[model samples]
Structure formats: C-alpha cells, structure tokens
Target: MTSKIKGLKHIIYDLSRINEWWLISAGFVLFAFLPYTFMHHGRVLDIEMFRILFTDPAVYIALLIVFSAQIFLFASNDYFDRDVDALDPGKRVRNPVCDGRVTLAGVRALLIVTAIIPLIASLYFGLLAFLFSALAMFIFYYYTAPPLRFKNKVFLDVLSHGLFVNTFPYFFCLVALMDFTVGTVFLLFAIMMRSTMAQMLQEIRDYHIDSQVEKNTVVVLGQKRAIWVVFSVYIVLFTVTTCLMLSYELFGWGIPMYYSIILILAISYIPIFRKLLKAKDYNREIERLWMGQGRTNRWQVAQYFASFSIYFILVIFLIITGYS
Candidate 1:
C-alpha cells in the first residue's frame, strides 16, 4: 500500500510539471477575466458585473474548455518533445519527464483525458467554439508531428507557437461572447505579434540546443540576427497596437483606459529591449547574461499579472460607462 501511494504521488507530480497545470490555470484566468475586466473597467470586485461574469453558464463552460485544451496541449508537447527536452541544457534540471519521473505513456493518457473534456465542451458551445478548439488541437499535433512538424521550421515555428498558444485562446474567449468584430480580430493579431516576438526571444535563449536539433527560428536566422528580429518585431507590435488603441479611444469605440494598459505593457518591455541592445555576443555565456533567466521568469509573471489587471480594470470602466 505504501509503495502504491508513493507511485501515485509521483504520478501527480509528473502530471503537474508535464502539463504545466499552474500556467494553464493562469491562462484560463486571463481568458475568463479579459472580457469581464473590460466590461467592468478597473472595478472587478463590483457586485453587479461580478455576478454576471460568474453566473453566465456559457462563459464559465467556455473557460473550462479553454483551460482543458491548454492542459492537453502542454502535456502532448512534453510527451512528444521528451527527447529534445532531455537535450535542453537549461531545462533538463527542471523537467519532470526528462528526469524519468513520468513515463511517456502516462503523459499520453493525461493528454487524451484532457483533450476529451475540451472536445465535449466545445461540441456544446457552438460551431465557433468547436472550430477554434479543434484548430487548437490540430495546431498542437502538427507542431510536434512529423511531415509537417511546423515547430522545426524556423519562422513558421515561432509563428505557429504564437498563433496557437496565445492568440487562439484569446480568440476562443471572444468567440464565446459572440464578439467577432474586426476590432477584436485586430486585437488578436496584435496579441499574436507580441507572443511571436516573445517566443523568438525565448528561441534566442535556447539557441544552442536549437542549433543542435536544427529546429527553430534562431537556428535558421542565426542568433545575432534573430535577436535583432525579435527587437524589431516588438517595436512594430507596440507601435501598431498603440495606434489601434488610440484610434479606438478617439472614435469612442473603446474606453481610454485601454491606452493606459498598453502604455504599461510598453514600459514592461523596456528592460528586455535594453538587454538586447547591450548584449555583446550570442554564445552561451552571453545568452545567459541577456536571457537573464531569473529576470525572464519575473517578467513573464509580471506580464501575466498585468494582463489580468488590465482586463479587470477595463471591465470596471466598461460597467461604469454603461458599455456592459
């Protein structure tokens, strides 16, 4: 019995790390709160909007599906990339599966279970939700699958990750609300751009392993050029997104508070931009310096927090302005 219990505990730990359950949970919260926050503005704790946000069955169900989809995708990635992950110098120590604590079969089983839940939810949600969910799964599969394994295709690899991982979830949320406006699409595009650039930066960090595997944008573009490309992409995304928000605010299409939120995000990128500019080389040591692994982790945490906070604030504003 004790042996069985130990096995169970190990399974749970493996699941937690492989599926990155915490990160998926964070993504779900971010998705659930984006519309709620925008509708309520900054006052997330308000009773009226809060009640509406929580009580809506469709919204809640959609969020659950999104969360499940993300979990499934994460697990599937770990299962497929176990070998590559074992080769990753920076991630080996932290990877649960790489350490052999979790069998690939266990991860595959978890993926199936996670995938089923979202699939059922999507079927009930409507065609748009179902379509996006299916697309998300397809993207994940193709990202790791052979023949068209886009994850190993340089620029397309980063693009696929950004679109499927970040923008798709955001789109799922909007689709749930039945808000398929051009503005929403443009917003998703901006998100895709930002996410792609961020992934590119991560590729720069993983340049060595990527080169070994011959599987990423940084490997194909070369480290120096890839870093510059990431910087350029960030600048363009920031500029375009800012202009769009300003136009929306000026035309009375969106609340001015979104502008403030965008400004905050822009400020958040300052350190990353500075590091890119000052970094002297693209080798391991230089990569370590610019990657600022600790700083990157902190920045990511901050970005997630900012994303939720901005959405919450926007929702409150929307409620006050009677947009809700």
Candidate 2:
C-alpha cells in the first residue's frame, strides 16, 4: 500500500510537469474566448457583427489554430532553451524538460500533435484562416529555428515577440469580429505596443542566463541600455494611447470604460517609469534589484491586473450601456 501511494504521487507530479493544463488554460483565456467576449461586448449593438463573429465556423477554427500554434511554440522554446533555462534561477523551478520530469521526445511528440491540430482547423475554416495560421506557424518556427532565429537577434527578437504576443492576439480578435474597423486596428496596435514593452522588460529578469547563452536582446544591449529601450518604447506607447483616448473622447465615441482602461494602464506605468529614472547603474546590484528580481514580479502583477481590468471594465460598460 505504501509503495502504491508513492507511485501514485510520482505520477501526479509528472503530470504537473507536463504543464499542458496551464497552457490550455491560458490559451482558453487569452485566445479561445477572450477576444470573442471582448467583441461581443464592444460591438454588441451591431447584430450583424455579433452573428458573424459568434456563429461563424471560420472564427472558431481560427481560434483553435491560434491556440495550437501557441502551444507548439511554447513547447519548442522549452526544447531549445533547455540548457539556458537550467541555469536560470527563475526558470529552473518549473522547467519540466530540464528538471527531467518531462523528456525531449515527449515534448517533440506534443509539438507534433500541436502542429497537426492547426492544420486540421485550417481545413475546416477558409483559405484566409489557413493562410493566417500558416503565417503564425512560420513565425514560431523562425523564432526557435537556427540561421534566421529571430530570438537571438536584438531588433528581430523584439519584433518577433511583438508579432507573436501582440499581433496574433489582435488578429484573433479582428478575425472573430469579421469586421476590421479603424477602432479595431487602433486597439490592435495598442495591444502590440504594450506587449512589446512588457517583453523588453522581461529580458531584464532573464539577463544572467541569456548572457550565458550569448543571445537575447538584453544581453546584446547590456542591462542599463536595455532598460532605457524598454522605458522609451513604453513611454511612447503611453503617449500614443493617451492621445488616442483623448481623441476617442473628443469624437464622442469614447466609452467611460475605455477611459477607465487607459487610466489604469497609465497608472500602472508610473512606477515602472520611476524605476527607469532611478536606475543609476546596470551592474549586478541594479540588475538584482531592478532587473534580476523585483521588476519581473511587479511587471507581471501589473500586466495581469491591467489586462483583466481592461476586459472587466469593458464588459461591465457593455452591460450597463444595455448593449448586452
């Protein structure tokens, strides 16, 4: 009985290491459902848009494809970054492949399964969906693959990160709505800019391991300069978004909820900006306090809080405005 219990415990632990549960959960939230929910509320007054977005098989299939591609991309990153991740204090705790809880072969098999799902989803959707899905796949492949590996390059790393994290989500939302309005395009660009800023900051947390790996933008640019880059981009984004919000209000198209989201994002950036200002040095001390540890935690918390608040406020506004 004791041996059996131990065996069961081991099984459970191994299952946890697979981390598919977390990935699927995130995919469902970020890709599969959130966009549709946002559009359903934002464009609720337009019955035709609602019907096209919610009832269309193409949109659903596109979401499926996006979800699958994300999973594969994540798994591939783990596969290639296993060595670097093993050395990363932040990554070591949960890195399945490096911890020996998950095998390369297993991850490869999972990637194959993930890749196949998108292809099947594309078949059910339309040619447009298929083409978009292929583009996402290519981006993921180039991100990890050699020669043109954008992950190792400075500008390309940021661009690729923006594309996968921001562009893909925006595209997913637009495709769901089946209508590409100016408002939708602006929202997409805002999301992309925000994601780019966040990703640049993230490099600070992984600086040590990334430096050892001799790749990643933070390593190439050095810490102080990297932080400056992060700050500059976000500052620009904050300015542009603020102006857009003001314009939205001036045009009488602004919902209170949109303003609320803008305010929240603005507030979230204040501390980050302060950190950038106070950063006098980029050695281990600054890296430890700002980059190595605290900044990542703060940024992650702020990111989730801001994103959730935006979605929640929008939904509430839709309901209150009698759109839903």
Candidate 3:
C-alpha cells in the first residue's frame, strides 16, 4: 500500500508540472468559471444552490466533466508542444514532457483517461451538457493537434478559443442549472471579450518562440502591431463590459465591479509598458512580465488579476446575500 501511494504521489506531481497550472489559472479557470458558476444559480446567491453544488453527486459529476475536459486539453497540448518546448531555451522548457520527466505515452494515457471522465459525466448530465462538452473537446483537440492545428493559425486560433475555452464552459454551467435565457447571450459575449484579451496577450508573450516555430498569430502582424492588438482588444473589452454593467443595473454593484475590472487591466499592463519603453530587449522583458515564471512575473500576475478577483468576489458576495 505504501508503494502504491508513493507511485500515485509521483504521478500526481508529474501531472501537476505538465498541466501548465499558471496558464490554466490565467486562461479561463479563474475569471470565467467562477462567475458562470455563480450566475447559474439565478445570477444571485442561493444557499440551496450552494449546498446542492457541494453535496450533490450530479454537481460533482458536472465539475468533474469540466475539470477532465481541461486536463485533456492541456495534456494533449503538452504532448504536441513537447518538441517546441524542448526548443525553447527559456524556463518554458521546464515542461515535464520536454524535460523527459514524463513520457509521451504517459501523457497520451493521461489524456485518454481524462477524456473518458467527461464522456461519462456528460452522459449523466443530459444532451445539452453532452453537446457542450463534446464541442469543446473537439475544438480543443483540433486547436493543438492535427493537419488543422488551429493554434498554429492566426484568426481561427483565437476565435476557436473564444468559443470553446470561454463560451462553452459557461454554457455548460447554465445547462446544469437549466437557466438558458436571452440575458445569457450578453454574458457570453462579455466573457468572450475577456477571453480574447487573455488569448491575445498569451500569443503576444509567446511571440519569439512561436514565431520561430512558424506558428501564426497576431504576432505575424509584428511586435508593435501585436501590442496594438492587445491594447485595442482591451479597450473594446473595457467598453463592452462598461456597457454591460450599465445595461444590468443589479442593485448598483454592476457598475463598480466592471470599472474595477478595467482598472485592474490598466494597472497590470502599464508597468510592463513602462519597462518596455526603457528596456534594451523590449520583447524579452515583455515575455518575462507576461508569462510570470520569472522574478517579476508575480507582480504582473497579481496586478493583472487584482481587480478581476475583487470583482469576482463581489459578485459572489452579492449572490450569497441575495442582492440583485
């Protein structure tokens, strides 16, 4: 039993390293999932819903489905990117798959195991949940794998992510709650805008390695152009969320929460820009700041998520208190 436990611990450690936990946190895990989970419970807090989420087997199953989907997606990407990861001289090469800490076959097995969980969970959740999971899985697979690797493509890469990564998860939660309505459309678009910002920033940060690997992104538009892309996307996102907050005057919290999100975005990137302006190697500095594995990454990451996290917490509080 002790040997079994040790083996399992080793396996979990390996998975954690390869999972790219930082990317998951920055990508869709934090901002998108939390808000949507709360929104599903009538866009306000309900103790019963919270209880159900914790104590109910179905809720656990749904959560497992989403978690497994993310694992499968990341694991597959790890497998596919191992070569490029090996090529990357930066700390990005710490990837278990690239560093020989885990084998390709091991990752493949992990992906297959995780893939099954979502399928089983989907069966339990009903057709809508099943459809959302399936579509997300398909897009995620094609996003990194294949003759049609969307991640290597420009517009399709970000657009597919906007749909699968950001939108599908929210829809899955809505299905679990059985609360599909017109207002949800606005919420979906709002989430899409935020997701796009994350995706564009990621692409921009990875410009050097990705360009060497011949992966096309807005980076193909060049560094200055890519920076502009990020800035413009944020502006549009800020504008849209402001409009959304105003449109949904939910007891006066919406405006402040959205403004807080904008503030966080501004705070997070401004320092990076200021540094970039004075840096000898602007791209390298930007990459370090954005990726957050280096010495200064934490400051950037904390600033980036500060206002967003607060907004999320505020929403959760409002929901729990039954505030509109």
Full-model lDDT for every candidate: 0.67, 0.63, 0.64
Q: Name the candidate, 1 or 3, with the larger TM-score value.
A: 1
In candidate 3, which residue pairs get closer than 3 Å at backbone N, Cα or C atoms, i.e. clash? 45-319
lDDT of 2 by residue, 32-111 (tens): 34445556667444666556657766556655666666667767776776787788666765556677766666777777
- Per-prediction TM-score to the true structure, in the order listed: 0.80, 0.73, 0.76
Rank by TM-score (best first): 1, 3, 2
What lDDT would candidate 2 get against the real structure? 0.63
User: Which model is ahead, 1 or 2, in terms of lDDT?
Assistant: 1
lDDT of candidate model 1 versus the reference: 0.67
**Per-residue alpha-carbon lDDT of model 1 for 48-91, expressed as tens digits?**
76666667677667767767776666666666677777886657
Candidate 2: residue 300 Cα off by (Å): 4.8
1 or 2, greater by TM-score: 1
Runs with alpha carbons beyond 4 Å of true place in candidate 3: 1-11, 14-49, 166-168, 178-187, 249-282, 294-296, 304-323
